[model samples]
Target: MFALITDIALTHIAGRGRQTLVSILGVALGVGFSIAMAALMQGSQEEFVTSLIDALPHVDITDEYRDPPRQPADLAFDVAAYSNLRPREDTRGILNATEAMTALRAFIKGNAVASLKVQAVARAGGAETGISLTGTDPVREALISSFDEDMRKGKLSDLRASPFGIVIGDKLAAKLTVDIGDTIVVSSTGDITRRFKVTGLFHTGVVAQDNAFGLVNLKAAQIIAGRPNAVNEIRVRLNDAQSARDVATQIERLIGYKSVSWQEANESLLEAFFIRNIIMFTVVGAILLVAGFGIFNIVSIITHEKSRDIAILKSLGFAERDVRLIFLSEGLAMGLAGSLLGWALGFGLTKVLASVKFEIAQATEVTHLPVTFDLLHYAIAASFAIIAAATAGYLPARKASKLNPVDIIRGAT
Candidate 1:
């Protein structure tokens, strides 16, 4: 019975060859475009995220608390009003730096770097600029970030060789009119100043980092900031970057400090990506929706032309369910054919896009466009096409199943 129904469906479809072909072509185009769009969008997002992960620490532990600490009066008395209350004075920055580092290294399945950060001014001759100065151990810092790859001139090891050595962004180098071997004066909030030699220059391609950030040796930063044996931030780089969130939570629990994963730090940007994906899929669905209408038109016409045959089949003991199945089969067959053809078309388009080469306008050189070819994309595209085809075929199939043989035959007279 299924064979007979499929045979009838194929005959009806082949009978109107041109219209059927057009309908299939519509579905094919829709699926093909959808697959290519998904590939490009997902590819670009993955590339951006990978770069972000490589550039930053997977988990960052800071001296600050997630919530403000309660005042001594509030904690002791639980009173709303207090007069002439003053908090106790204490030194800032992560306390017991050596102990914390030892504890963290044992607890964490990753590399950790403790760093002192300060806001400072960099002056070279007449030109001066505000910069965020970071003090770190060069050997340890290299484990977490892509600093080695980002170095445009001189090596990171140069910082260790020259105790007062500093690495500035290439853009900052251009701004200060300074180069390697030149001297720059750095002043911190404590009004202490120190002369630092420019040992290296780095270009990370991020304008903010390149334009205003500087790196120096930990001991040198401490001396410049008038602080001894201080570290405010502990950055961790896990072997598996994806486990950052879990590790961050555990670190915060163990150390009583606020730990933040990279994902949490860039929450707003990730939300934007979510919204973009929604928009992308919505557009793809709309394309498939338009293509479904083409299938509807062709099926409706076929039903109208085959009215006499449908009535005859019904009179020959064919059930209405069988009649519906026949048309449904035709729709599904076309959908399957279109989906397969679209897969090939989409693959070709993605390959071509990935092969095209061009220079990016940014400081970094990217020769080829990013494109991901995943099987999930092909599966999603096919699912949309099949569902659209089934819906488009159903309306006309339902109407054909209800046709009365007596009326159809009498009307033929």
Candidate 2:
């Protein structure tokens, strides 16, 4: 019985071959676009996240808060609390860094933690550049950062071998007109001055980092910054990046300093991605809904043209439910066909996008557009298409089922 109903449905659809083809193609276009868009957006997001994770620490333990919490108001008389705010500048370096690092290592076992000092370096030729002079244990820093992988020239371990040796970015090397075996003058505002030999150069694919960042031995950096055995920042890389926020909170509670996760630092960027996803889904969904309307129009026309046939089937002992199922079957078949074709088309489009080559300024690694072949995108697109098509067919099928055989047959006679 089910086979007979499906055959009848197919025959009806075949009778209007051109209209059925058009409807299928419409749905296919919608689904294809949705799949392709999702692939590109998701791929781009993944790439962005990978770069961000590689470049930044999962959590940073800074010396002090940028803006400390305001003092509580006076309880007596419900009066506002007022205190003299002075312009005295205190040292910004972290105190007791060695003890802090030791405590942190014991607490967060199996995690990578390194100290860093950021300061300005000026050349004797009057060229001053602000650089993040990272102070690190060569072996331990490698565990936390991708510096070893991104090393263009020179060994990171060399910084340890030579106390006065420094590893600078390629862009900074160019600006300072210095190279390996060349000496550059470095000075800080605290009357700390030194001449260091450039032993190596690196490129991290980030323009800012490449332009103004350098690395040196932790002891050397402390001496250069005029803060003996002091570090301004503590960077930690956890086993799981997703657990950074929780770990950061734990660190703050254990120690009396500010701890920040990468996610917290880039909250605005994450919000932007979220909003973009919402907009993309809404636009694609509207396209699929429009395609569904095409199916509705075609099905409605078929029901009207076959009204007499429906009445004949009813008079010949066919149940109303059977008649409705036949029409619904037609819709389901069309939707299934369209979804399959759309998946193939979308896959082809994603491949084509991945093959296209392009260059972006400051993003040296992006040689081609990113297009991920994720099955989830295809599943979502197909599911939406099928649901939309089935819904469109339901209304016309219901109307046909409700028609009275007595009235339809009487009118025909």
Candidate 3:
């Protein structure tokens, strides 16, 4: 009975011809706006989360000896007092970084702490481009974290393959104008220099990590930098990301050192994302409200025009509930139809946006915007649109149902 009434209401609107065109259009526009907003959020948020996840290792344990801190106080004051401290700034220097890296590698492999400092630099394109090498053990790096398959051009170089062999980022490759197997000169802050062949390029789609920090064999890096077995920091990866802080605290106590999480490592970017998300919600909410107005006005007009029909139905011994259902059906039908149409339209539009990349070439050359359409997003947006339409009809439907049968009958006669 409910389904039949909804069908009748939809047919009635079609029969109204040009008069109801505006109503249909309004409903369609509202649904479209809701869908578009949802699509944008889904695409943008996924892009951000995925990029960050790819760029940063899920969990890491760095050496407490020389914490890579932006401020002096950021480093743990509980660090062991080294009687033989180096001059100014950092105490670990090249030798210490290598040793820390070596110990970290061995420790991760279920052995004693193979602490060592690994350092290496890779020539990306020319003097204009720089690709800094991350000194870490190949075995430990492989166990730490991984990126999407599409991002990697090939496997990382052999751990003991070459003294200056380096892994690169796809974004970094594009920036420096280089490719795998290409030879570039690497220079270290310690005045050490070496020529390294690009072994592979990993794309992760993370602009920061890919464009700045590539990877190199810790041992090879140590050799190239002329600092055998000295590492600036020790990095540890665990099974869970959330457990990092607790594990870090435990590690700090056990090793008598400082430890950090991925969140701390990338706080600036995370904060920026939080702000962006809030802005998105604010803007999208306003847009959806504007769309809701379309439903409201259409449902209101439909009730006004069908006054006599509602009255006749009540006079024919039909319950006010039935009359209410008829009007409610009209709004729901409109919502269902429009939401489906809008979903299809929005899906296509997202692809168009992806292909028609932004032309902001001034800062960087990221041509296309990435978009991913997930079914979950579609379900959420469509459900909301339907509920909004149902609610839009409730008041107007109630008013129509409450009308006295005599008034409508008299007006019709």
Candidate 4:
């Protein structure tokens, strides 16, 4: 019975060859474009995440608490109704640096480095700019950041070669009109000031970091910030970056300071990506919905033309359920054919996108468009197409099944 229904369905579909072909084409285009779009969006997101992971520490432990410390009076007394109490002015650097470092090194399965970061002003001749000055161990810093690879001029080790040497972004260098070996005066809010030589220039490709960041030796930054033997930031580079969130939580609990993973640091951007995915899928769904309308139109016309045939089949002992199945099968067969063709088209388009190359003004080399060809995308597209086809077919199938054979025959007579 199933074979008979399917054969009759195919015959009806073939009877209107042009309309069937057109409807199938519509579905094919929708699925193909949807697959390509999904691949592009997901691939771009993956590349962006990879770049973020490469550019930042897996876990960053900072000398700040998640919640402000309770007042000493509050800690000393639980049922205190305190008023007009001033908070104590405490130093901001991490306490007991040596012990903390030892404990962290023992707990972490990765390389860790401590650094003092302070806000300062850099002046060279007539040009001046506010900058974040970072004091770090040059050799150890390489393990946590891309500074080693981002340097466009001179070596990171130059910071150690000259005690007062500093490395800054290329954009900052251009703004200050200073080059390597030039002297610059750095001053901080703590009334500390020093003169340093420009040792190296790095181009990180991030305009903000390139314009406002400077690096120096750990001791020099501490001296300038008026904090001796202190570090306010500890950056960790894990063997596996994916474990950052868990490691960050552990560090904060153990050390009683705020620890942030790369994902946490870029939470807003991640949220934006989520929103983008929603918008992408919505548009794709809209496209498929439009394609479904084409199927609906063709099937409605077929039902009208096949009214006599439907009546004859009912007279020859075909049940209404079998009659409905015949029409439904026609829709599904078209959907299956379209989905198969769409997959091929989608693969070709993705490959074409991947092969196309373009150069960015700031980038040093040409790059191809990122495109991921995941089987999941194909599956999703096909599923949507099939559902659309089934729905489109079901509406007309229901209408055709309700036709009274005796009435249809009498009307024809």
Best by TM-score: 1
Report every candidate's CA lDDT. Answer: 0.90, 0.84, 0.63, 0.90
By TM-score, the better pick of 3 and 4 is: 4
Compared with the true structure, what per-residue lDDT tens digits does model 1 show for residues 1-413?
89999999999999999989988888899899989999999999999999899988999988898886887668888566867866665367887878889998997888999999989999999999999999999989888888878998998889999999999999999999999999999999889999999999999988899999999999999998888888999999999888898899898888888999999998898899999999999999999888889888888898999999999999899999999998888888888888888899889888988998898777356577889999999999999999999998988999999999899999987
TM-score of 4: 0.90
lDDT of 3 by residue, 10-115 (tens): 7766766564565555555555555565567656766766655544554444544434444453366745445664567444533344444454444342211232
Supply the TM-score for candidate 3: 0.66
In the order shown, the candidates' Cα RMSDs to the true structure are 1.8, 2.7, 6.9, 2.6
For all predicted structures, in order, the TM-scores are 0.95, 0.91, 0.66, 0.90
Clashing pairs in 1: none
Candidate 2 vs candidate 3, TM-score winner: 2
- Model 1, residue 294: distance off in Å is 1.0
lDDT of 4 by residue, 181-204 (tens): 998899998879999999999998
For candidate 4, the per-residue lDDT at 110 reads 87
Q: Distance (Å) between predicted and true CA of 313, model 3?
A: 2.4
lDDT of 2 by residue, 1-413 (tens): 99999999999999999999999998899889999999999999889977887789888888886457454554344668566956556566667777777888886744555575758665736566877788888878888888878888888878877898888899998898888888888887666888888988899978888898888888878887776767778888877888888888888887767999889988899899999999999988898899889888888888988999999998888898998898888787788788899999899899999899877776666598877899999999999988988888888999999899889889989
